[model samples]
Target chain A: MSGLTPREWLGLEATHNPHRWYLPVIPRLSVREIFLFGGAGLAAATTALEETTERPVVWATAQYLDFAKVGETMDLDVHVSVSGRYTTQARVIGRVGDREIITVNAALGRRELDLTETWPTPPDVRSPDACRPRGYDYDQDSLGKHLDQRFAPTTGKKLGGPTGHGPGRLCVWTKPPDGVGNSAATLAVFGDFVPMGISNVASQPVGSNSLDNTLRIIDVRPSEWYLLDIEAGGIANGFGHGQLRIWDDQGNLQAIASQSVVVRDRLKR
Target chain B: MSGLTPREWLGLEATHNPHRWYLPVIPRLSVREIFLFGGAGLAAATTALEETTERPVVWATAQYLDFAKVGETMDLDVHVSVSGRYTTQARVIGRVGDREIITVNAALGRRELDLTETWPTPPDVRSPDACRPRGYDYDQDSLGKHLDQRFAPTTGKKLGGPTGHGPGRLCVWTKPPDGVGNSAATLAVFGDFVPMGISNVASQPVGSNSLDNTLRIIDVRPSEWYLLDIEAGGIANGFGHGQLRIWDDQGNLQAIASQSVVVRDRLKR
Candidate 1:
């Protein structure tokens, strides 16, 4: 966390051209050492866009098209479609060699306005220190190992565990080793938990592949631990949809994200 | 509805090339007779992508960058990034001349799976016929004129009315002149109600312009009147965020949409 930019933390390298960036898919940036994690890919693209535009991201949506393996590299090309006085519309297309892997569309910039209010209250839960550590089946070489997660008391089931019929809601306190210090890219990485919540709601160890991930920023503040309040909207026809409200320790809403995933049974994997 | 496809219904004219489409922004396709409606623009893009890919839309997201005023023609260019056996990844870049107005990225196709489930249930409300007709203050030359809207009994307030501080939820029954016949594009048009819901939650006659609209289709069935259950997420820094769950008369979830908008005082307009 020593004044390191998110691009440096994610091992994203800058080219001589301002609109181009690349990330080597190291083990820490991948999922189970198999492919680039969806959130990590999104974070890489976000960092690249922010660096090129020199603006804070307001909203970004990334669609996962293919996979970049652990040893491959993802090259991102930034395109600025419109640059307004107060906002900019841009996109980043990431590819490994000639094969496209991800496409991220985003808006970045801020307007000076007086109004500010948040209505959704955070769930009353114990602090991260009081919660039990979350358990996962993946090895240490995956992206999940880089995050420290704790299940709230309201979380009806543990990861890869059974659950009873309920409202399909899960609350978890997550923290990275270096902390999310006012970086939207860091929060984007944590926003990938919707798939975990989907499995909890299904009452089975279900595996999901995200087709799209959208992050809507309300406000980003430096915080050590953030709460991920995940709720499953619905699951139908082999697809699952859900949303998460990320909150700082003081109960301030940081960002809201929603995603749709392709659901499959874990046994098949 | 006749034998009209969604492209035909939206007046999207196809060019000799398969990847090109255009829409003349008529009053019925605009808002306030001033600019193209955000959802209509998205629906136009979705229609173009579907027509080009020859597939059903699973999810589509559009980022509104600029305005396409009434009487203007929007030209859409469809790009298929990946055409898999069961799913296709594509995007539509829409513009009025050289000004980019909207960008829509989508995934389309369906898979045969033995599993199907929907966790979120529709709210218990009276039939559409039992509700009072919704009132609006706009003229006849707008998209709102084509929609028949009814205030649900659970709705605490009407459009442009005062409201008590609550959870910021509004339910309404809306029907187009022609029913939504398994068309995701038609449902995309209805997904633009987040701004209206924002005004209701604020208890003021506020105005909002959409920045991004994301639609995730779960199941679509033909129905006369569809229920729009809108919930306001939060408002901060002159930006409003909200989501909606669209349901048919039979209580089946048709789609879920989330949006972010720039908030303004209606008095200024």
Candidate 2:
């Protein structure tokens, strides 16, 4: 069965410069069907560098400046700022025409050492079998359509949970389509769900436009399901800040993700 | 008496190119009087751009590539990646000669909005007055001398503390010299102390050399004392990951910072 490659999902194309790439903003990878979601752009940039340097991205932080609407193309220019024996620090600029949309800086490399520990134990929640699936319907109106989501018992309560009102935490079991594979880039895409928590906790239709998304990749292992543990911390001055922990099905901490978003109160509008 | 301006402390010199500034690595700013501390570089880069753009840095992340020693100088090249009416996204590269030492990406601007909230409450720890002062002495061998650190009651238990032997959390009240004003740049410096928590929680003498430090500025209020609530999480594959929340004395969440570090065991050596 032939299907689209992960690169195709990202709409990444090769450029004359090996360090640079061209990516298209397609609906399949967009959040609101209007612009490229923060995660998709992060995935494309890191994936391109992962393929180029043949190293895993240890940490990458992308500061989103503007948006690339569906049908727009972004030119990703990657630069290896410094190359060391065990690590390489790099930067990528994603632009559409003369307008820059996203700028990402990353550290890529792997070293072998004998220290390992994961602090937060996964909360004992019902398995995906017991949870309700969300955002799986292939709808152009929502970015959730691209992933399979099962709301854990702790998921935003007002939206249909064992509900709560204040900014607390949410947990969900989610996974991309089977074709995406297990990679740091995939982790980046899944790690962009903190905004969902913001809306969920608000219990009202609130919109959040992320100013920046930072992902720190801890470990990448093959797993069909990943759990998102999101904590919505503070909201002030029309902005919200939160942190998310991405864990595989086996409860292994894979990455720590954080974001700050510009809040849009739909009720006010 | 007129003190040296913030720019003078940063030693930022004007370049023929308006977009570029030169910075010197001085002992007063060095962590151990050798190489430039992570926070100093971050401060210099952001201060330079803050002066040029006449805006405050909202978020800045720096990936440490190499060290700029006490006599060496770095050229900070700033670029305005995107400029919006109320915000500007920019990147800065700090290089010594042809070698890149630090790369920083930041968001700068101030907007008027009516939403405000701070979630994380300050942990009930001993005040700086009740806690023991650390790194207060001007010691050339330690980074502590640069800041006044008062270990909260939860500080290292095993490395001669109340004695615990597992990865845990540490909280401290820390502040830069009185001469340094409280700005986002000052927060950046205080947020670079995860390495201390690593050593505190490890029990033994271990060193965590950070690969990158990312600071998400939440609020930059003028305060003499800032609290660092650091959680030292996973340690594996010879690396460690941790997150810190910066709070002002009034229990306001100022910034969320995280880092990944290369772990070194002095016992093994």
Candidate 3:
């Protein structure tokens, strides 16, 4: 039997319908698939709620449940829990018909003007084209080609010695061949960097995919370049934590996203 | 009179001691300020861990416990809540000499090769410059000049109805003023996109500023034009929620962000 492609499974519901799509979980897709799936759910939720309530997507946070495979179809669902003129809330889940794959809670809101507190700016660098590309052993694979990256000048070219591999703060321009804009595409982009931090600081290039991913998108221009300044600390063994600053050229200061990633020991670039 | 910056307090034995920063409290900065100060504490922690453990920041999630302010000096006190080879966890606090301003728990990990997953790609659109520069209602008196923005072809151009706002995904090219990378410049660039999600979508051109900011730099980059793709939703009580995707020009996804902004009301352009 012909199995459903990822896009086919995703298209099951209209943008406004609050439902989950469950197709055979592709083992290859893993939680990484869930990351984008969750993003798709978020996209539907944002679009539906905004049009229905005449609002827009403000912020959302989600967790991945488990690895999914391609042959088995999973259940995808979304619920509009709270709907207000200025904001809306949703709870979403994905399951393998019975076994759950992921759960998400997203909030949507109307635009408002207020004075709150936010992050400051980072340092400067040249345009993406003018910058040097730090080649990695993995650059030869899908991870490298699907990117449009430009690194800052202050940073070292490749990964290196202890002192935690490198300093806090890294900026690179990235996107799939599609450029930037699509929500699911963003997920694909972020998941790619899950290893850059480790690769830069480690003496040699290392590779690790996200076990589970979490993201928080701050307000920013969809058409402008985004700067990701990252910092990490405390890696005694294989696992550790990192923080990131997602910014745009317009000075809109976006949200902060943080999550836990699993390190696969055998992989190398 | 003597003045102290967040960095200065970080230098003092009482405040700098990773074991003893959040002891005192100053009320003017408010509980929110305390939470932000708590952010400062982690900023310091992230800096130190980078030097000692030398691991790439793979994952980090921090919640604001309280808030702090500009004029007063705050402290950073840290404790290792969990330690492992793959990850190390730390809990740190920010305080005003005697009172606690904020607290946080963060995770760090090692780096390696990334696994699989694919997400949706955006329907290609024209470059951002095709759009015009739009004027926003946000009071960017401080950030206006600091931010170098050129909106989408229709940025400030006239459009009808609020019906077309889309999480369908949009794009922009962004850059900050020169010399904003290291020192305090890094924070400034990250801080600028705080309200970009809203600004990117609003029919009337509204903007949000950064307030109560949190940043996690997973990768470090100098300065470059990072692509920012954002989606806004969950509008209620004049407040909105949105997410941001940061990419390099080559279409590599680098960072993801989200924020909560108050969308006071919609207006016709």
Candidate 4:
């Protein structure tokens, strides 16, 4: 689409044995690539040597690595030590200009059993189309092209956006095209979505940088639409905490994410 | 301590369910206050609870219920339900301002014995007093006040008092001032130390805000000093990720902590 070959548009940071992948922190592609890579890895791991995918694969636990500029290529290789019965593990490397920008270790697994008694009831709320987007315009610097955010309520809406005097929850739909598979590529994609916990909610007109992002995939139910139920609270000084639960179309809880939040407005020394 | 005594600090939300707590958001506290509440709860959960606590209390997902403000005294309560052989579940509530500020469902567990394995080798490292702290000054906002962050570098230099950077791995000594015993109250205190995973490293000078903190009590080795080999990667687009494997002074892997990080600067934004 960018008038370049697949290899030219995005390069794979791959190598053999002691498998390795390298990706750049390009401003334009770094974040999206990481999500796609992570998500793809997980998808790849789940289905085995399955069919090549073309549809937008739905996945979760997308965290930001580093920013790749307008023209940097990222490399993603898989280090599958053990693709075990119930689970598997993969390590990722993201690089830019000889710098390994991000490295991730992700655990891949299939939905083996049902925890009906323990899990929370899915929120009986609005559809993705009903919710309006907020954080995208918070600050231009905080927004990314790769993220297609759709929130029913906009930033100015004082109430009903999840936190209004009501239930501080917001429903968000993030579309990272390459982040919906089970391969190392899938893991790389999903790992970049961790910031959506805030990006989809409070950070509009303001954005904060994250120090670390971690995701644990509880179940694997891949889909075309990745949904996030993001919420935040308990802000004392300036930092607080929040969580994101990713569900597929069937409304099954696929993965859950949590992170320490640094409210950008309060942290500017 | 107020005119209401325990009743003064007590208030339930409209969504309050006797079997479960639904918290409204607290608007007074800044982001920092939420962080303090989370850290305090971690310490309280880790050190206070006896048999019903999550082994390592790996923070799975922490969702902010509503807007929480500062200066208000927040009350947090935890109910342990079903302590399974491998998994333990708990209901947590955070309250303030005539409302429950937040509620969470936490799952604590030990490594499933179905897949027995070996812990990693203790890095050839130094003693706690050997390294300097890598983070910035500790204030009421940091988890450090609740922890004793003493480092002994086996491979890297002493961290430069909180904000400096070092190796991918390091060793440190941590202990809750009030020991976590075999009691429910103690579980509250045990989890406060899990955030040290990033503060001990010398990469970015960002304060930590935990979204969801999870820990697995490895051995529960009785000791005055614990060893933590913290490693984290997957830092893309400003968001990062990390994990820590804690060992008793005896080199036993006593616990494992993994957290998703939001990178806000020290003073907080």
Candidate 5:
């Protein structure tokens, strides 16, 4: 363990100003060392929001406006719109120089109530130890390489393989590197896998550029592995929509995420 | 039919500045004449963004910061963050005087692609004609009065009634008064039903103050009635989460909405 928070692992730097934060786009934060990963950008914004408000994130939605390529620095400006006794509503706009990269609106804080319940049951799947390590077509130093992922038994064929047309759903167990604890920022990184689930649904070498990602936190608990139960709702008009239910290894529901992505066909190398 | 567009029906007026719009929170636009309906506020923002960007909204998410009560006027400021060749990323910040009420981030425009499909099948329920009108415990002059809703066959009990502990799901056929049409803004207005669905899930006299609502448009087609398939995901730490699937009578998926609300216990008179 690096004894670093998820924010530190992302290399998010704090300026003297409480409302301003900076993130340098390193190769580990990029996709294929080309551009910043969408989830990492959101995680950066989320980290800033939580820090500025001094409250845990309850929910956050990020709209991807542009790309911040590797080697660029993103400046995040946090704006607190409303700060009530129980909750704080804020937003963060990230830009590289003059180009806007992402906008995130979030609600933070909590309320005391006696009611607590969850309705959705976690999918029945083998433990992460019983599953095989997930393989990636592109072997590059990027965000995906830092995490350990295993496909559950339900995921019949590996990605980029042939499959019968079925309900667009995939289950995978993921464990981040040692220092990345069960923080909301860490879950934001895992929530960006909806585009990958879309590829399985389409049965092709197709992925997406996310237009927006919305994450709703239920309960974040520490566990060795988290199951990403992803289901693609549909694809139409060159856009695909899907959602993910994150479950800890102890069968605790942690968070829920939904996203809309711009569908793009990938050329097989 | 009043022949007014959904924007006009909401009383959204264009200001001298191209990036500014105004909405008067009249009783018809409010909930129980208390505050602006959460969905109506989002609809107003969607209208402003659509007019300013001249692009159909692909998806929009709104975070409710404060309440704009009846008799207040909301000023919406539209900001275009990035305008790409085929898509535009923008946001609308609505304020009542000096208090910020809502912040909406959206992506708009369309792309030309032949790929189109919807995987989730609509629930098997009786047609709207065969269903009974949904009864509201509180009769007031508000937005709910303007919408004609019918409980689907699966919805066995009405609000504030006893229900067997089962999966937290409800379906209702809703038809807005004439002239609403099938615009993205109209869908925004209907997408705010997640809070109502939570009441059914808890099997108690409970509702919520919305924290955020996110809507993703799939295919908007005009129909007399739209089926709102709502399912409550869970409730924990004084917050509830749920999602909705809107379908036209023709079995076409119209849109998908997800929301997080601060759960509140309603008093029975």
Candidate 6:
């Protein structure tokens, strides 16, 4: 919050209380921005606690309760529940006045070990420049406009149709706004885009409101673009469940994320 | 806690306080039993709160902080963080005296909606009776003896060897001990077996200790065998991450579960 980098321009301002932070929901960062802040803001507060303990976060899960709208300011308060030699467990509560918006549980630690391998190999797809640039004409207010994305070769152009032709999966090359650098906070922001896969495989126009966004930080490497491989596992009884793997340009798996959302049929609405 | 069934024998004894429960780690319930208790105990406490609220739990996540050993009794305290018309957010802390073993955050609701579908089809495999019974002989003290399992045809007989020959996955028919019924609490207990796949595919003897177990409950049906389709996403930087889809005998998807674990090379140890 001090020397503002483009990434820090998430509008997260530190408060007098060291454990607390505030974020104002700006227009560009509003709609899907909730997912970004729901993850990034919570990660920011958790990261702040890391400064004192000097530990890196291994995992963080944000349970989203309510949505934050444009012009609304959200408050994030982090409390370290337990601190051990190698790990720290913390919880962050995000609120808008009396209403709670989100709650994040985080585990932080940095212990080096020899075991290392990524089982899922990145698909050999065309470079980002070769694919069509993804647009937000479907939802004019989509936060997709804030970031740049190129649909992967396997992806279809339609929003809602039959995706059963293949596994319920979608891949996209997502890049944060210019000047934003790759970091845990940025990865958390980018990992929440899996719900788009629900609509991608839907039979009609449907929107999903995520109940939780769980990000398991692996290793964030500096790169211009992040590859998000999303698999929508199931959609049943008004809810949709999915998992996403965030990979760096070098094909290093950075983080694993999963979520459950309340799916609403926009066309029926 | 009263008139207990085999499933109820999770050894979760209720206290005078309505919001509190205790778990005694017995022989059959030791080792991985702690994870079962960590999830089931929290679900028990959350379900108790449901008697008054009449809402079923939709999702629950347990973060493993410390180990609850044999001969030790753990306490589960449930705190309802927020209660809404269709949803309730709560947290349960499991502790042994001053030491916290696990923390669970749950979302409960009873909203009925028409949208229903499971994208992932149940694998076409041999029935439970046709497959060979799976057991654990490596660890004499293994809690696996308490339940019954049948290995899927696609799974290899070797526990720790290369598994890249097939899809990075494993399927098993898991059944709780006698008298245990198919309940959400039981499903919670059974959803934590993804680690078996690690050893199933590992080239060396490796043991995985889960850091977190997250279960997203869908629909529970009456069935003798629960199909666990586990996919080992990756093992990198000393950690292994995976997801499991729980299905009933009728091929109805019940829950989607995921976990992150710290892998230890037992042969080296």
Candidate 1 local lDDT, A167-231, one digit each (tens): 67778888864633657778788788899888877755677889999998888887888898887
lDDT of 5 at A166: 40
Interface root-mean-square deviation, each candidate: 1.5, 2.0, 10.8, 21.4, 1.0, 2.1
Q: Write the per-residue lDDT of candidate 2 for residues B1-269, one digit (tens) a residue.
A: 11445676566788888789988787778877789889878888888778777877777888888899888999999988877777777889899999889888887776665556655566666668888887444557444575788877743334322222224677788876757766766777877887777777764577878887877777877667788888776776667778888988888888888888877877776
* Clashing residue pairs, backbone N/CA/C < 3 A, model 6: B159-B199
- Residue A44 deviation, candidate 5, in Å? 1.5
- The top-ranked prediction according to lDDT is 5
Ranking of predictions according to lDDT = 5, 1, 2, 6, 3, 4
Interface RMSD for candidate 3 relative to the native interface: 10.8
Task: Point out the worst 10-residue segment of candidate 3 chain B by lDDT.
Answer: B115-124
TM-score of 1: 0.92
lDDT of 5 by residue, B168-196 (tens): 77788899766777888789988999987
Model 2 lDDT per residue over A139-203, tens place = 45545676788877743334332222234577888977646667777888887888987777654
What candidate 5 gets wrong by more than 4 Å, as runs, is A1-3, A155-166, A267-269, B1-3, B155-166, B267-269
lDDT of 4 by residue, A159-193 (tens): 55443322346656655444333233333334434
**Local error of candidate 3 at residue A155 (angstroms):** 9.3
In order of appearance, the predictions have TM-scores of: 0.92, 0.89, 0.44, 0.41, 0.93, 0.86
* lDDT scores of the candidates, listed in order: 0.83, 0.77, 0.43, 0.42, 0.85, 0.70
Using TM-score as the measure, the top candidate is: 5
B191 Cα displacement, candidate 6 (Å): 2.0
lDDT tens digits, residue span B1-269, model 1: 43567776689999999999999998888888899989999999988988899988888999998999998999999999889877888999999999989999998887655556666767666788888887777665778777888767643333322222246777778887563355887789889998878887775567788889999998878888888888788776667888888999999988999998878867655
**Candidate 5 chain B weakest ten by summed lDDT:** B156-165
Tens-place lDDT per residue, model 3, B95-203, is: 6656544343345554333422212132233455464443556442332334355443323333321212243234555654344332222232333353565654554
| Candidate closer to the true structure by TM-score (higher is better), 3 or 6 | 6
**Per-model tally of clashing residue pairs:** 0, 10, 192, 187, 0, 1
**Which candidate number maximizes DockQ?**
5
RMSD of each candidate relative to the true structure = 3.2, 3.8, 14.7, 23.2, 3.3, 4.2
Q: List the candidate 2 regions with Cα displacement exceeding 4 Å.
A: A1-5, A8-11, A15-17, A135-142, A155-166, A202-205, B1-5, B13-18, B135-143, B154-167, B203-205
